[model samples]
Target: MEGDFIKINEWLKPLSWLYGCIIGFRNFLFDVGVLKSRAFDIPVISVGNITVGGTGKTPHVEYLIRLLKDRFNVAVLSRGYKRRTKGYIVADANTIMTDIGDEPFQMKQKFPKVTVAVDAKRVHGIETLMDSDKKIDVILLDDAFQHRYVKPGINILLVDYHRLIIYDKLLPAGRLREPLSGKNRADIVIITKCPDALRPMEFRVVTKAMDLFPYQDLFFTKLAYDDLKHLYNGSTRELNSIGSDEHVLLLTGIASPRQLREDLKPYVKNLTPLRFPDHHEFNDDDVQLINETFANMPSPKIVITTEKDAVRINDTKGLSKEIKDNIYSLPVKIKFLLEQEEVFNEKIISYVRKNSRNSILAKTKDDDKSKDSHNSGNGSRTISF
Candidate 1:
């Protein structure tokens, strides 16, 4: 329930060292093929982070769906973190938050045409998807950077602008799930949650600290909030309409909500925040607390939650059925402010296309060699280089 990132204390230092060594060794084992990686016949584009939560993985995954949906059959796979389910489940219009987890449900609800699947074991999830009726051309693995068992064709790593990996230590010490040197695994590194007025010098400093491998590409992005929506009825609300006299309870279960609180501070009379673990599943106990807290507040008190948490609470019945109607969710989207958006998209598209063509060429050559061997008296196959 701790809201501040600064609260991660000195005790985490030694713990972080131990965690860092474990992460490093695990990754090395994968790289050296001591541990095996599984690949589906379809390509997977993994979007994840080395650091822990709130680097904006959801938005980037959604961004990719928006960018590539028309031309490709993309299937999104996530490890339904706090779901009640035990095995892989495909997300559909009828899929409940309790079944497939909130984010996957939200994705399925948002993009009805796309395929969404969830399992703690992502490789198993991918296998299940391939066996299904859906004609999946490619897969998008959500938050799978540390999952070295599956190799993605293009690995896009997101880093928060405020919480650069360079400043973080592994696990308990700081937010990083892996060491800074693990940046070598990234194909493209995106710095998310950037300030609109960020300076060139600041960007250079981060890049220098990252010390990216020669093959890695990096970009910067920011979150752009659309008009605020009411959590109760999903009604559109103007960001400016809410008066300063309105006291509000901000309920967030995200990794970092500091930016959110700071942005809304000017408009609210008073902001009381309730924090929970990232991707937390609210139970009856949580609902009771929210109920008691809201009942004591004066009139015009509104309950606000993030979009991800909104989906999770939709099934909770502990809060009065009527009170549930009052809750609201703030929806946000990623905005890549680069001047060369088309160029960036083109680079990604071209890389995939080139790789696909090479695979086809190699297959065609193999077929020809097989035919030649069958026709020849020597019965020895020869493939031209």
Candidate 2:
């Protein structure tokens, strides 16, 4: 079966090449100005990847939100993949997963203070946010690296360390959405899901392989898993609390679960994973299957899933009470490796501070103050920088 799969992929290379040409042409049009790319006055930072599946985009966006929310009114805009709603829709307390997609809803639930909106047309989405009453200082575009129509102030590209674009191919044959040359478009390139203790030589090798421009900044980040939390209630448990004798039914719908599976191995006696496609919408039949699987498991067993999957599973109806009670979501965060935290923070902060409209407005206010002092018959006070 494995050999046959390889043969099939080999046969599909021609189609992948054809797909590559069409994508390459579209990018070329945008690159040379044949296709118009809109630019927003406010600082717009985009987080995305060339690959089709998860490369820790959502977590990194969340990291940015945490980094900037205290100082600026941050807003997030996404395409709301697989959402039922057609046009632009701003998330509210009443919004459901079906309204703005699961990821947006999950973000809203986690950070109620931040504004989250979804629109297929990102330009329209930005316009709507600008027209709204919310005082948005910065906009973070999620999963929009290839969305060249709206040019962002800072373009961040995420590449999975295990599935680097250098070793990947175009769609139908592999997971990449565009050619590896697309990496040139990114202003900041982050190698995501890196091992915790990456050696200096390994880092140098990856950096040399990427061959980034002098202007592009490179950073490495790894996922930091937190203690398990109950899906419904707000209870937490240590990993070792699961006991060495307990069995675990690992349930997930994300694109990559291998790392997560390995992380849970030492804690559980045995793991039985029920993997699903990325962004899978759970149905009644799926719920029934989960219930049966849980029932068949031995005593002291529990169901564990990624934080992203928890959003959809929690929304799914007809889940048995027993299943709901035992399910938990493992929280994860992006941690910059090799003590690059300060450098990463400085770069992001400097970009936003330099491009933000608020910065210009503040400068104008300072100028007005100087003029007012001059007009009031007082010598203009010298402002020390």
Candidate 3:
């Protein structure tokens, strides 16, 4: 399947070239001020990738939420890809996946205190957020690398270690939304899904390949898989508990399931993957098919899916009780590699502290003292590097 995809992409090189030209022209227009970009008074940090699919954007956004929620009122803004709704919608307790899209819904679920809102027009969205009663101090823009209309204070560009932009072509022929030169706009460049054991020499090679500007801070991060949690209930099980005698049916609607599959291989006796398009909304037929597939498998079998897919799956009506009982979701978190956690955390904190709209609050002696304490590792949310 992967080889076929590569061949198809190779055959579409001409289309890719055309697409690249169009994207480049659009970017040039933005750069030359032919197209106006709006900048907000408050800090707006964007976490995005050049590629069309997942490069671990959600986890990194969640990381930022964890880092800033205690110090400031953080709000996340996304375009809400594939949402049924049409306009700006702020996620609340009653909001569903269909209302605000899967990723935003998931983030809202994880961080109820932090605001999560979606709108196609980001400038309008930022305005709406600013006008809201909630005292929002900062905004995190998810998957907005190509959103040139809103100028983010800190633009973070994520690059998948396995699928570097240096080795990729434009869309249709490759996953990139724009040319590799687009990376120059980023303030920080992160290499995501890297191996924990990656050596300094390997990092240097990747750095050389990226050819990042001196102003751009490069970092590496790996996904840390947590124990499996039941989809319907709050019960948990160790990842290794699914022994070699058990049959595993992996269901995924994400762009890349290779890492999840590899993680589950050592524990399960037989692994079968049911793949779907990214952000796929589950339907009655899909649930029925899952049931049929699960029923045919041998005893001691179970179904597993990603945390993102689990959000949509749990929302599917008419899902069988048996399937619901057997299903589990694997959670993942971002772990910065080579003890760079402090560096990343300091950079983010410094940005927010510097750009906050409350100039008096940011410049006060008390605020400076508090920041000094935080720097000295005495704060409530001290990130260890």
Candidate 1 Cα deviation (angstroms), residue 322? 6.7
Q: What is the lDDT of candidate 1?
A: 0.79
TM-score for each predicted model, relative to the true structure: 0.85, 0.95, 0.90
Return the clash pairs for model 3, or none: none
Q: Tens digit of lDDT per residue, candidate 3, span 1-385?
A: 9999878988999999999999999999999999989998889999998997789999999999999999988999999989999989999999889989899999999999999999999999999999994478899999998899999999999998888899988888888899889999999999998876689999999999999889999999988888899998879999888877788899999997776676566677699899988999877788788888888888788888888998998778877677788899889999998899999999999888777766435456566676778788865442321
Order the candidates by TM-score, highest first — what do you get?
2, 3, 1
C-alpha RMSD between model 3 and the true structure:
6.3
Please tell me which model should have the higher TM-score, number 1 or number 3.
3
Worst 10 residues of 2 by lDDT: 376-385
Better of 1 and 2 by TM-score: 2
- Please list the C-alpha lDDT of all candidates, in the order they appear: 0.79, 0.89, 0.89
Model 1 lDDT at residue 273? 87
User: Under the 3 Å rule for N, CA and C atoms, how many clashes does model 1 have?
Assistant: 3
Stretches of candidate 1 off by over 4 Å are 1-12, 266-269, 320-325, 352-385
Highest TM-score, which number?
2
